[model samples]
Target: MTRVRGTPSPSAPARDDVTSLLRHASLTRFLIARVGSITAQQMLMLAISWHMYDLTSSAWDLGLVGLFQFIPGLATTLLAGHCADRMHRGRMVAICLAAQAVTAALLVVSTATHSVTREVLLGLSLVLGAIRPFQMAGQQALLPMLVPPSLLARSMALSTVVQQISVIAGPALGGVLFAISVVTVYLTSAALFCMSAVMYAFVRYDYIPSPREPVTAESILAGLRFIWRNPLLLGGISLDLFAVLFGGATALLPVYAKEILHVGPQGLGLLRSAPAAGALCVGLILSRRAIGSGVGKKLLIAVAVYGISIAGFGLSRWFPASLLLLAISGGADTISVIVRQTLVQLETPDRMRGRVAAVNTLFIGASNQLGEFESGVTASALGVVGSVVLGGCATILVSLMWSRLFKPLATRDALR
Candidate 1:
């Protein structure tokens, strides 16, 4: 065959220049699966929180739910990271999804049978907590393998956008379902998880398992060691840990929805969705615009803004005002999340990605759960308004302290 070769096609380069993050087949498939799974998870979370409060109006009981969820992640962090490094990540994620589907189904049954108690809910949270670390570690580690290095930041931003979309929609859906019947919410969540598992099955990727090593105490501690040794990573992770631990005002929304805001379950859903609504908008913007220089300073500024917004949320009595405040907080948080995740992913080697990701998961899980627990405890003692205000102030202080303490984090200029 004789072919005349001329100038190369401009279409190829033009297509490459287009900035859509979902261009890659593997990334697109993974994101679709993630959207389904995240939507289900968010719906389930709202259902569980509302159901727990309906059973017992006590704040401490709500806190215990978070505590139970945190314990499993704390206990099995190392083992989960190790598994992500050595196991088939896709298969592991599918298995985790299967387990979660079963759990959701059980909740449906329990709700229908009128046997769903706070204790039962707590138990299920423990099961989920155990499954989450492994699932998250595997997914985080697998992302770099799926996308070109240059597209990683955009991919992360796009992922956040999907998650934020789910966060906004899921709670609204859950509230509608819960209004019809609590059982319906659980059933829908179960169906979504099963669907997510099927979508995950379609993702094509290869896992290069880490070299085999004897499971030892030191081996298990590798993730923690890596974070500790790297100041930038340490600062980024710890900044998030402390900020969320102190500034988490969202945990008290259920209380505000009922007691302060005078809103019904539907209204509660709106409140739950507000922050994510803001986050979704911000993530969409970030997906297209690259993070420029002074990445560290931007992160710090974002966290401080988050704290300010949280405080504003705590003081607002009007529903619209509160929602706006929460949305601003979410927007600020989105920036911090993007910077922190990108930093962690770009800095770590592939061999250590799983372990480092596990450590990051632990910090995030702990901050969320423990923050919920703290909010609940403080609400019980200090009153909801006081607790939220105090926590928000603490978050602001944390941001300042971290900026001074970890100069490297504040001085960071670029993603690479």
Candidate 2:
């Protein structure tokens, strides 16, 4: 097993990495199950949101749907991480998925019987919010178990590809099905959830037992301390938090597409999709060739590139230019995300990965929600373009500041 200390295992034939990855039955099954579950999640989200609107016709309720999910997801982060560390990770994911499946089935029955109501939807949303952190904790912690350290990054890239594709396809599929029948979408999504849960139950991995740490305030907080004590982990995670917090302009896409670019709803869809398209391309490239050296520097550069692209997107008046800028931003973000995740997974010990991952997820979740709020407030004050441009600049500044503040992270030579 002699190899680069912090690099992925020796490179397989470029063509074979993916095949090699697939040949690992556990990883393969998990990936397949992910496609089903994530796609179903997207479909379920769309159906629920649309149904809520149909029932209440209130935009405030639509916003409440997200708020409910976010707050609970945020509130349960530490406990969820503890569970991931203590539990059978894959089975934990299976249970979560199974719960979701039941929820979807209930939705189907309710919709069919005209028994669905806004309150039911909100309550379910609360349940979903609580479930997500547990699922995420288990799923992310489980990946390293299914693959060796060397293959972790490549596997993550491939996983990203699966996610991007699922995110893209799910809504469209759900939309088409919804147009046919709302009940149809729910039933289909429920089936997918059940399939993913069953597949997850069968995906096996070797396990090393972490001490059955007493569930204490200190134990729940251990992951946070572990990350803080490790500079690379802290830098990588915080960099993602701040960079995305400032650079993400997703909330402003509608403003640009509608008023600035004059592109209308059809164009807005394309704008919304530009980043995913870009991320998909980069994820594919990384699946074959991961960042091997100069890991820290590359991560910073990627964040900087993301910032520049966001700034460019903010300034662009042409529809095509906006798309290109957003795509570039997406590609850069994919690199940042992969690098950050790799760092977090590889640097942390197995027993502690769950807690560390939980903390990581919290940073990310906060960034996404706060980023949108920041964008809206700034757009209101600075004008949409000014707000976006300033946010991008702030992102770039964060990258530069982080590079200096976390030199160990910035000068790190490898990801292993």
Candidate 3:
């Protein structure tokens, strides 16, 4: 396998040494690419949700939007994964961004014409979601190629930070724009998507996707087999899958803004961004410091912290307490994400990265939307506080169960 220059090859001394880890130039370029994409994604999501709710005034509509996006991921993931492996990664990303741009344009046009409907928005969301797995899988697959195996963790950490920034800024910006005019928000999102497309166009990597052997059932199954066989990948992904599926608190933010918390639109925006702010802080810290020898243990512990923080947030009636708890939860969740992303990038091969990453996207997308669904349904049944608190508790319980069932993921050697 060809390695990027100025990087410590896997054969080199362990990357515990800081000097060796900081030498790669491609890492910078790779991070730039990820940041660009993440910023666009965050902005788009923020704008879309804001517009959707403004038009529909229904929590069920929001839940349905989440569902629309996630359902397509279930269908296109393997096929997208296969394409990622067979095609050029950079071009594939470019194509995805272009598609996003088109979607954004359509949204703008629809909104401008006052022709936007919940059904149209939901249909567009599903299409975007279908293409999302491929984009995400392609990017994850391409990262390892840009940097050395040893720095994969750090690279993912940096990307996480950038994403957090996007998360923080996007909604706040979207909210401001939405207050000005819904059409303005849509236009801004479209512009951001175009900016991302342009940034991706400038990435000068030789990213021809790896060519796998001829297509067959066995070839398609190869990626799944690899993920299934790898204890670390399976355990980490699964742990997050169940953990986030129950613990995710996003769906309730709208409710908090509208009813329980009584903070209003600004509060809603802040609530949306609270987790990302915490994650951004954690990301900055991780970028400078090594994750240490016990990254596995740290990941588990961080998630536990996430659960505790979320539970605390759920129980809080005070706005400040709620915000602080949510921020803390976000920080803890960031740690788990960095660890998981690092392990996946390091362990998966370039050829199968798309498939594995698509699978990863599937889990993530499912957890995100399903979490929303679970929250929505449970909230409808149990009240907001009860639902959120229960979800947080379920996350902790799931973590404990996963630790017992897949204890090997908690060791550093599993990653190696």
lDDT of each: 0.85, 0.81, 0.77
TM-score versus the correct structure, for each prediction: 0.95, 0.84, 0.92
What TM-score would you give candidate 2 relative to the actual structure? Answer: 0.84
**Global Cα RMSD, each model:** 4.5, 4.3, 2.4
Local accuracy of candidate 1 as per-residue lDDT tens digits, 140-254: 8777777656667777888899899989989999888877898999999999999998877766665555578988878778989999999999999999999999898666788
Q: Taking the tens digit of each residue's C-alpha lDDT, what string does model 3 give over 1-416?
A: 45765556676665544344445655555565666566667667766665677787666677777888888888887777787788767677778888887898888898888888888989999998898988887777777776666666766777788789888887777667767776776677667666666655555445554555786777766778898999988999988888888898786787777677887666877888889899999988887676777778888888888888888888888988888898898899988988898888778767678788878878898889778877778877887888889988988888777777777787664344
Look at candidate 1 and tell me the lDDT of residue 73.
95
- Order of models, best TM-score first: 1, 3, 2
Judge candidate 3 against the unseen true structure and give its global Cα lDDT, from 0 to 1: 0.77
The runs of at least 3 residues in candidate 1 whose Cα sits more than 4 Å from the true structure, single-residue gaps closed, are 1-20
Model 3 spans > 4 angstroms off: 5-25, 206-209, 212-214, 413-416
Cand. 2 Cα-lDDT: 0.81
Residue pairs in clash, model 1: none
- Model 2 sits at a Cα RMSD from the real structure of 4.3
Output the TM-score of candidate 3: 0.92
- By lDDT, the better pick of 2 and 3 is 2
